[model samples]
Target: MISFPFSKTPSVYLKGERLFLREPQWSDYRQWANLREKSRAFLTPWEPVWRDDELEKSSFRLRLRHYSEEARSGNAWSLFLFRRSDNVLLGGITLGNIRRGVAQSGQIGYWCGAPHAGQGYMFDALKLVIPFAFSELRLHRLEAACIPSNLRSVRLLEKAGFLLEGTLRSYLKINGLWQDHLLYSLIEGEEQRRGLSVKTTAV
Candidate 1:
């Protein structure tokens, strides 16, 4: 495990065996743009409609600003996953829409570059994140929703110890249409009960 100060804004850097997760940086614009551009077709079906300037540097700057505000306010933690061996950008994961007080929950969302899909990188990333959400963040629950047709996501969540909770009709607008989504959740003690071992350093 490695640790170091990240940024002035609230942020995290998580190190795993094969990869690491860190807040998106201004210097990452080119890599981010390249990955997203190449994976656009593969990802569009599951994501919101993209803007014409979605890959432009200005739009990326705006995204970073929004991410900064979310982190500063403790509303979310957005991180980009990178392969540690060669430092290649692999994907991104976020814990968003965090609720505190009695609820103490957050929603999890992620996207992987097309080239990296179905390669187990995300599974490793999720293993690292689940523990952080439950232990470091001290959250009671973490939730995720995916369209029923997205079997890959369904399997990833289940493999990460998230149980199928129920379904939400018209839950989110994806690819320009409202779609039904299967909801899944993992409680604080559930992962351990499911025999999950996650070890990562956060700083």
Candidate 2:
């Protein structure tokens, strides 16, 4: 069954034609660890510090606890982006720091394995995420930050219907380094979000 990261409501399951976005389960640990291990060099550049156990089986429970809090409050969506054709793990994407009420906004962040980096997977995942945020969570805006050096990510955001909002200087620290990032955002009624759906696939 699909599980949500938020507590007040359930929006745990989302799907696209060739992809499925769902809550992560303990069974997913091995795959996640393998992906991270194989893509260590590729991903470590953008990741935070990790202890040896952070990605271990023991850490799954701690992650579950954190996700439960996010689910209850509608503050986040930590979905595993996977390919339906072969059940291969593509990457992870999320809508974090969600603020409801009058703003109804949240931020988007994502990463894909090196082998799957340029295959349009992230864009496809964004399509489903946008619908999940706007339709299921009733969020009005989605924001994303990317390092200025990450031209690939910038293009993906553009293809996914996000507009460049501006730039933030040293707004975030990644891989232990503070850096400037390009900011992008998409509102609920934007052109890219017009036909957004959880059933949309990355094919």
Candidate 3:
């Protein structure tokens, strides 16, 4: 069973007014695949082409191994975002590539279920996670990269108190093509002082 206020595993379930974040587990395979399959059309335009082995149990086994490694190294927090009221699987948010010796930072990456786009749930989700990253994990900064054309994600980061730092030319490979990304970052302990509070947006 999972415990709370604990390690990077299935510790406390983070709850917001509409959603909660939980650690991924074997039981989530079906729900995760369903949402991912349904979101393919919407996601494919921005994500890499799916490999034939992506959904196999063999792949999942590898994933579990990687998840364990990431957690043990304190280099990532991979979570499943779910609807609080009905427990629907919405999407996932990953805080990856964490560094601590000098640069205590991690990159935030996320995707929403097809049915949940254009809603502020992602932003609310970020709000809750950011504080936890800073306070609980003692992170110094968090960053996200968005395609220049992804106005939605860019706006979401801005609304969540991240500043547009710069752009990375051809920084990522998406849908089989190299894409540029606009970088956004927020330093720990600064958003509140700047009068920036997390706000909600609805579809």
Highest-TM-score candidate: 1
Instruction: Write candidate 1's Cα lDDT for 119-185 as tens digits.
Output: 9999999988888888888999999999999999999999988999899999999999999999999
In candidate 3, residue 36 scores what lDDT?
A: 84
Candidate 3 lDDT tens digits, 1-203 = 12533544434356768888876778888888888888888888777778888777778778777876786667887888988889889988988999988999999999998988987889878876887777778889999999988888888888888999999999989989999999999998876776653433222
lDDT of 2 by residue, 75-186 (tens): 8878888898999998999889999778999999998988888888888888778877776678899999998778888888887888898989988878889888899999
lDDT of 1 at 52: 98
TM-score, each model?
A: 0.95, 0.88, 0.88
lDDT of 1: 0.92
Model 1 C-alpha RMSD vs. true structure (Å) is: 1.9
- Give model 3's TM-score versus the native structure: 0.88
At residue 176, candidate 2 shows an lDDT of: 86
Overall local distance difference test of candidate 2: 0.80
Local distance difference test, each candidate: 0.92, 0.80, 0.80
- Which candidate achieves the best lDDT against the true structure? 1
Candidate 1: stretches off by over 4 Å: 1-7
lDDT for 7 (candidate 1):
57
Candidate 2, which ten residues in sequence have the lowest lDDT sum? Answer: 194-203
lDDT of 3 at 138: 84
**Residue 5, model 1, lDDT:** 43
